[model samples]
Target: MNVVLSAVSGISASLGEDAVVGITIVILVFLFSMQRFGTDKVGLSFAPILILWFALISGIGLYNLVKHDIGVLRAFNPKCIYDYFKRNGFKQGWLSLGGIFLCITGSEAMFADLGHFNVRAIQISFSSVVFPAIVIAYIGEAAFLRKFPDKASNTFYACVPGHLYWPTFVIAILASIIASQSMVSGAFSIISQAQNLGCFPKVKVVHTSTKHKGQVYIPDINYMLMIACILVSAAFKTSTKMSHAYGIAVVCDMTITTFLVCFIMLVIWKKNIWLVALFLPFGCIELLYLSSQMTKFTKGGFVPLVLAFFLTALMGIWHYVQKERYMFELNNKISVESLGKLVNKENINRMPGIGVLYSELVQGIPPIFSHFIANIPSIHSVVVFVSIKAIPIATVALEERFLFRRMEPRGHNIFCCVLRHGYRDVLGDHEEFEFQLVHYLKEFITQETIMHEAEATTTTVEQITSIHIHTNENEVAHISHGYTIDDTLTKEGKHSSNGSSSGSITMLRVANSYSLSSSHMEGVEKEIKFIEKAMEKGVVHMLGEAEVVANPKSSIFNKIVINYVYSFLRKNFRQVDKVMAIPHNRLLKVGMTYEI
Candidate 1:
């Protein structure tokens, strides 16, 4: 909406404000649809050259365009606006307000593109290229419009002579296409993030390229958008009609961000009440301006609301179900423990190894720790990691040595790893992190002269056994909505026997039978309490969605041990549910796992 407002307000003199505002719809469509391509192809290949081309060509025309209007500067003054408004009256004001819908549509682009192109890069691009160009064009257009109002047609196409019109239109179209590329790319990035956090469901994801995390392709989103573009174009008949649909999505999205920010302020930042009070009321004013747009709802605002609401609701549901499933699985796995009982058990205290409990959320108490302690009653002397990280993609570099220390609290053998990103950065090694870990660990542990058990006089040494309980691009922990080609065929029940799909994802049911890991040390029930306490310790980091799959070699389990544990684990891993998006249609069954 800001884009549209800026364009219209600035260009109204030459293009006729309505013309610029109208052009924004097509430009927006152009921007959102062409985003699936890799950025090097888009930005490096097209953006730099094209942006340069835009400047070169536009710059060439700037002298002539600006020559007509010495008085164009009047529009920029606050005082001139008061005179123009007195002349035009409230009808013009309301029309301007109505048209302002064009500006707010892409508001989600900010949050959706938060991680991409770097925040600095986006800010720079906006401030440098987009902003200045718009200013020049609007000023030039205003001069043209004021000189010969006939040239200021509401349609950009109508402004040019018959011969030059097509060429100008074509150039304009090309510009629109480039803009679409930016937006669509942004949508893919946002949806991917949402999917990672269970704000959305599974889609066939195509990483746009190896290097750029921002360039992603969701076949579902693409197709949905394609259809939506067509439908919107046809139904609205003009950009003006579609303009009405704009504010709903943008406003609703902003509202969500506002609420989420509030939560962050309270829970994450722990800010003072007065500070929250100061800024929130101001933000509310912005929110109200966006919300007031809903008055145009019947005109065409319902579409985006429906689109975004379905998205929000689907995300909310996925979050709910995923949380529910985690609880259910956890309940079955963890055994209750009393610290006093565990400390007294002489043969069952502590273990010589590392215990890294991996989970999507990593609840403070997990079932497996006590279960391990109960069976391995003699297991003690262990270093427990309670990781607080999300999977899918955002992984901090391992070299970030600062992170490991950030997790350590009050100094104990237990070192916490509060990695900020998904699985990759947490699982992989970073140079700085390795150096920091070596120095910090050595310093912290070296003083404790004895190792392992007390009788021998040596301390127990434990390797940092880091495992990534992965959340796929869909952001699911375990395999609640997945299936491999093998499983798909088998589930098909012998009709298409022995067929193999190379692209299929065979999700092993995690909480059910197949995905469960059964081996445990013996006679360690006495130390169980400490392990349970350690389960949620900040050291055990994890990601929301990851590629750390079940051992592929577990084909042995696929055959021989397919009975009890394997089936239970596999139950959690199966892709039994899928939610189609864009238009929000429910196609597959709620728990129907699919292959490919």
Candidate 2:
């Protein structure tokens, strides 16, 4: 077994230092470019070419079979594996076991290209082309080993006639380079998911070029992986050595997935052991077996483990920051008395104006929304909108209707809308979504009425009418419309919760994009200008869109900047009163109440 591993590593290394360099360069360049060419083209161009490469590999192995002299059948011997293990003892036995797990370096490809191929297509491709190629390539190497007892360089190349050896080596390098594309694409998909869940910082993703939702690009992740792969490929200088770094992350992720799968089943499926056992154990055993085979941690397997820590730490910090923000909002409430006095002193006149403030939070509904509603009690309506992230491609069965059932209840005379996007869509847009929602509610609302129904399927939950008004984009002339994403949505992909847009309420929405700190201010000026214009038109009750910094440092930092800018501006312009708060955080939620 040790002899075989040494031979394998020697063969891969003999491809030369330049070949590994060539492979890494090929990998990164092709990887970034793949986002544009897409999955179908990759399949179109590479699939057939890979088939030819496999055929040539097999032919070389079969030709060498006739010349084999040292126990020709040893090439076909399973007993040799047992005998080698028995002689080498347990420590060396485990070393032999390590050789088998290298096959999974490309396992991420299965997940990365999941968008390109349905489960069935990938199964078929693996069974027909990929599976056979792996088997024959090993067998071809084994056949050559029987023919030549002690060749130091690649047996696969030496087995070829002298004229074809270098050419075949070149072919082998190209195959390894192409294999790196799968890893690059896989990293893109993982980081994108992290961004959507708010577990990682937002990175730009491109979606329009491919039908494959998994096809994406993250500039940071791309650069990071490129540097890491090059360093390892150079340090180890062989796929066989880098193989250790590759499989550790794969095994741990597999273990994590298995556990997550179990949790999803137990909690989501009500702890149905039979279904969990029946469906999960097979995969569980396979990954565990792979992990056991990957026991060579000191030999380079620790690379992926190191990476896992970084990811976990990043997500942990993000969640902690958010929890701190909620603590502030839940504890603070603005005053209606001061807000009411401000609205009246301004001496504004309009029929009735309303603004719906949207926040991408599940908790700590901003106090501003409530302050405005309470203060101006007579100025039309105000809505506090909270958005929820969606779960894509949920297999809840098409016949299984009733997509979501929101059991929690609050908000009297309020409007709430649940928005979900497709799996393919990665971006979330709140302000533009408000216009569509306002247009939707206008269809059911009446002029003098103040009641409306969101969905009228259940007789008991009838419609509640509200005032007739449209939140038009033209009202805020200079603010640019937000961006929309192409997500393959479930019933509740992107969510927006709308409460009443009543009175001269300060519907303050804190925490807009770019930075949780000062970046929130990037959109604030535009928001403020919009509010100011409404005020000039005799429609100024109070409405605002601001960001709540999740971290205390950020919150203090941002609020200080905003207060400084705000105080200077107010003294230069006009002074107002009162503030509001609404729920906005990880889960799509918000609450209405005034903050003083």
Q: In candidate 1, what are the lDDT values of residues 359-450, reduced to their tens digit? A: 33332333444444565564323343333344344233332211222122222234433323332233223234334443434322311111
**TM-score list, all predictions:** 0.53, 0.60
What's the C-alpha lDDT at position 30 in model 1?
Answer: 51
What overall lDDT, based on C-alpha atoms, would model 2 receive against the true structure?
A: 0.47
What residue runs in model 1 are displaced by over 4 Å at the alpha carbon?
1-37, 56-67, 100-113, 150-155, 158-167, 251-292, 334-456, 460-596
Residue-level lDDT of model 2, residues 1-596, one tens digit each, is: 11112222424446665664555555555555554554455656566556767777767766665555434545466887677768898676665555556545455557767755688988888888777776666665666776565862455556777776666655655555455566666667777787666565544555434345566666656666666655655576555566666666666667677878888988987877887888687576657556565676888777777777866865655554445444555565333353344335444332323444343433334455554445444432333333444444322221111111111221112333334434443324433443444443332122101111211222121222222122342432221111111111222233222211112111111122111123323333444354344333431222333343223444664455334433233234211111112223212222342211
- Candidate 1, run of 10 with poorest lDDT: 587-596
- In each prediction, how many residue pairs overlap at the backbone (N, C-alpha, C within less than 3 A)? 94, 70
Where does model 2 exceed 4 Å of error? 1-19, 40-43, 66-78, 161-174, 254-296, 323-356, 361-365, 368-596
